[model samples]
Target: MNNSNTAFELTIVVPVFNEEDNLERVKQEFDSYLSKSPYRSKVLFVNDGSSDNSQMFIESICKSSNKYSYLQLSNNMGLSAALKAGIDYANTEFVGYIDSDLQTTPFDFDLLMEYRHDYALVTGVRQNRKDSFVKNMSSKIANGFRRYMTKDTAEDTGCPLKIMKTDYAKKIPFFTGMHRFIPALIMLQDGKIKQVPVQHFPRIAGEAKYHLFNRMIGPFKDCFAYRWMKKRYINYEIINQG
Candidate 1:
């Protein structure tokens, strides 16, 4: 890790799994963001035990850029685990998440940062999504169900382009589908969230990790899990500590 990179205020964690084809584009997009971002920023590529050449590409990217680094998971623990690992690893004041696929632009992070001061979480809502009809409808159903269950009011929880304060992010409990409930989790901590419209593009390479079953049934199950956690969640404030 570059010592100077530690001075950054924001760390963007890009979780990767079998996204070897997308690494280069990811690097370029983030590198461009770092050059133009209002806040001092760096990118942390989390390798979620990708069985492809993703690690090789990640290592190469990290080696070539001081603004880039990575964490390698032992195996494919799924998106929630990978996101949690990245959040745990982040030491900056704020952390952001973006998918390895170039569907969302890293540049949109700047828009999220604009509301960073007022909201504990700032996430993107993709405008004019370029996915297939099945993908779009499934996502809409999933989002609607999640909103009804968690009452997070997040239109696009699965947008994948989000920024949140590191402290708030660290407070979230790790679970298989925690990634889908980030805004709700922040709300659990009595934190505020803001959503901004962001540009979305079609995937240029690599296969999507999710399917109809996982997108619909998986989130349906996780919604109940979230409700259970919400009921049992505990929050308190300490006036003083010795």
Candidate 2:
């Protein structure tokens, strides 16, 4: 349940799975970000049934400040599900996303916020990623295939630092791999997106959730699923409300 203060203009959603080692750092980074953010913003931690002590950490973090709240899923739903839940629960003009891993810093969110008014979504493209060779290669291949198939031209869909207008975000259909196609999904609704370069860091704690097979094969298959959905995707306008 959300234990928040006044309504915020932006709600930053951090999807947590089993990042027990990283929650304290997450709170610190967010505290710094929210304290200096130009727009009023708060954070929501979507704990996806963390078998570790992540839930306890989240609870303690939220209790310490009204700027934070969290939702705990019943089971270990994937990242896509966690993200969807956060978006749904957000009651703000803009919804932001960041991973708990801290590969991308929450401070870079300031860069994306610059274009928040003009674009439906502003996403970060990680600069000089600090992952292993295999992970980097698989991500490159997957990103190439996704762009080729979806033609979304999203430079780094997996960067995990994004801010999108809440209305556009809620319109996106949820799927197991919806996280990879956020730009494409927004484009399907005739929404514009801006991609900006953001700082990248090596993971200092916890384990990387993705590997070569899931990173490469999952997006490849999801690309087909996205293509199928795109062909039948619906868009409409209401010219009159009288």
Candidate 3:
């Protein structure tokens, strides 16, 4: 474990996949956030084998700022894999996650941070989403179905902004769509979750990764998988240890 006094209390993982155009703005946004963050925080960019120049930009940004570091995957394993890799590498007390597209602001992390001590996970619920009709509606349908299946009670599980205790996050079982079920996974461990309203924006650069089909169908299937895992998840506490 990293010494709390010396290392950052939180590390925000920014998972990147062909986000070349968004890298510069991402650096500026996170840099500004760190300057004003209440908790000592740093950014960790996880490159999921971006085929574009995204890795170059990530390297440049990391070199220019000590607040930034990164992990590069050998191939594109998708968001869940990248997130799991980031959480596995994180050594801070708390770990945060945000998209590189900047749909959710890094500034709102303050709101989530305020409740970090009270819950295992603090996730954002985007208020007044600025996405297309299809995207928004599909997400709503998916979220509703997911809530019914998992009973996680998360209003907006698709929200990209979230803060999680490193211990709980590291314990989450990783799956193909694990990123979409963070709150549910935390709940499976008997941990609490808090959701706060946050700002949302339209994509400034690069393309949206998921479309209606994947957004809806992928989550629909994964919800069942979560149900299967929930039934068998094991939890135990040790009373004595040598």
Candidate 4:
């Protein structure tokens, strides 16, 4: 990794899994944001061991552009692993997470970033999700369960738009489904989290890797893991002046 002459304001991490069809659109949208947005940011594409043409597409994009770059895992490591890799490589002051499916626009980062100054983490909630009934209902059910279990109280845990300080992000313990547990994990470190409404659109291409079982059950199991971590979590603050 090349050290920047100065720290970047934000580094947006996009976890992709066989998203070949949507790759170019993601590129165009992010590229436009980098050029037109108020904040200076870099895009990191974590090609999460995609079996499709995603790896090659990412390689091409990185070769052609300096503003965008990518990292490929030896094999599939899921979203949590991809995000951990991105967070580990992050050299910016703040890091952001978004989906490559194009359902969540990167421009929404503009809104989330505005609140990052006030909170360690700023997340987005879909106002009117453009998804199927089954998809939407399943998400609601899972989110409701998550809220009841963890008491994070955010409207959308699955919304792809989030921005947070890199230092605070690094403190959260890594675990499966850690992506969805960001608010709770941040709270573990006494980090404040903010939520805001953002635009959500339907997926234009590529199949979702997660289904109801994987989305709901998988997170439910991980919620237990989170509770365990919370019980064992350690937090400390300085008591004396520097």
Candidate 5:
């Protein structure tokens, strides 16, 4: 049975895809963070149709504490859909995101929470990333191109560690490459975003799903799609409502 007594103020969505090797540590680290979090927080693991034992691990974790819950997709819909599912299902004032690979620590959420009130989205910029040369180079090229095209001014939109008001997150329009345009989409809603430096570590388990094509070439093409959409996006304000 779930701990019905726990009060949840924030939902940290962890999207998992064949990450059975790291779920044990994920449970430990997240549990530690929840124990001392300033806000009453819960972890929601979205299993993106993993063929491994990830689903079993997630189920076990959720059963261990009411602080944890999960959503299992029918098939692998990629990160964008998995994240959108989690965001839509989240019933908290704020929603948080972190990768399951353990490169980014759940503890950095405290750093983001520091500015959560002032900014619509608070994202972490990994300092001294522990990725390979090709991965780093591709990310730089992709991020630079995205900035030039979208003009979102986000230092590291690719950084997986982030927190945003659940309302703004839910308002974001969804698409195939939607994950790459989160900060830009938030900006479309006239939302404020703050990026802060955070620790980055080398991945100890599970293989990275991205490659040169998806990381660099794919985002390069998505920039044009984003530009096209940006011109057509609509927003409004109601000063007088009875």
Candidate 6:
């Protein structure tokens, strides 16, 4: 219920887990990016109940910078919950998202924001994914199946960069793997979503957080959910004046 007033022009949500090593680098990257971005943007860090020193690092970053801010859940929530929480609390016209592992460059947001006006959501597709063969192949298989089921056809829904209208992003239902269905969900609501190619880098410090189960099995089940919702999803418009 907080942030009821519209103030920030953009809120960039950074979802973090046990990424203590990458935390400071993430803040500096965003701070440097905000210096040049046309629209003033504030960074929101969501700590997903990390048992590490992630919360302390987030607080230090917030205290050092006025544009930086953060929130920590009582316990670890999944990525979907963390993202939805940020969107719910965001009081900006545009809410952007990126991961804390530093896989994607924060400054690449300029590419997405350029088309922000015409799109309800702007997402990134990694043309040259900087992942291992196993990671890359598994993602491809998952993406293909997801497209067949949900028919969203987003080349890289797994890419960790996006900018969306706060209102539309807030309306998306919070399923466990709903993060993968953002473009599809926006399409279902008759909203426009643009996908742009962005830079991808290898993880520098922390270990790969995703395992085979979460990447392959988790998304498989959620795809079925997306299809089910797609069939029964509600959409209506008022026709005429009284």
Note the Cα lDDT for every prediction shown: 0.91, 0.93, 0.92, 0.88, 0.91, 0.87
After superposing candidate 3 on the true structure, give the runs of residues whose Cα lies further than 4 Å from its correct spot. 1-5
- Minimum summed lDDT over a 10-residue window in model 1 is located at 1-10
What is the per-residue lDDT of model 5 for residues 79-125, given as tens digits with 9 covering 90 to 100?
99999999988888889999999899999999998998899999999
Report the C-alpha lDDT of model 4 over 135-226, residue by residue, as the tens digit. 89999998998888888987898898899899998887987788888998888888888999999999999998888789778988988888
Better of 3 and 4 by TM-score: 3
Candidate 3 per-residue lDDT, tens place, 1-242, comes to 22232558888899999999999999888888888877789888999999999999999998886778899999999999999999998888999999999999999999999999999999999999999999999999999999999999999998999999999999999989989999999998889999999999999999999999999899999999999999999976579999
Best by TM-score: 2
For all predicted structures, in order, the TM-scores are 0.97, 0.97, 0.97, 0.96, 0.96, 0.94
Clashing pairs in 5: none
Candidate 3 residue pairs in clash (backbone atoms < 3 Å): none
Prediction 3 global C-alpha lDDT: 0.92
Candidate 4: regions farther than 4 A off: 5-7, 238-242
Weakest 10 consecutive residues, lDDT, candidate 4? 1-10
* Candidate number of the best lDDT: 2
Instruction: Supply every candidate's count of residue pairs whose N, Cα or C atoms clash at under 3 angstroms.
Output: 0, 0, 0, 0, 0, 0
| Model 1 Cα lDDT, one tens digit per residue, 79-194 | 99999988988888899999999899988888889898899999999999999999999999999999999999999999989999998999998799889999999999999999
Error of 6 at 52 (Å): 0.1
User: Candidate 6's residue-wise lDDT over 1-242, tens digit each?
Assistant: 23533446888899889999999898788778888877778889999999999999999998886788888999988899999989988888999999999899988888888998899999998877789988998999999998888878688889999999887888787778899999999888789888898989999988888976689999999998888888888876669988
Task: Pull out the clashing pairs in model 1.
Answer: none
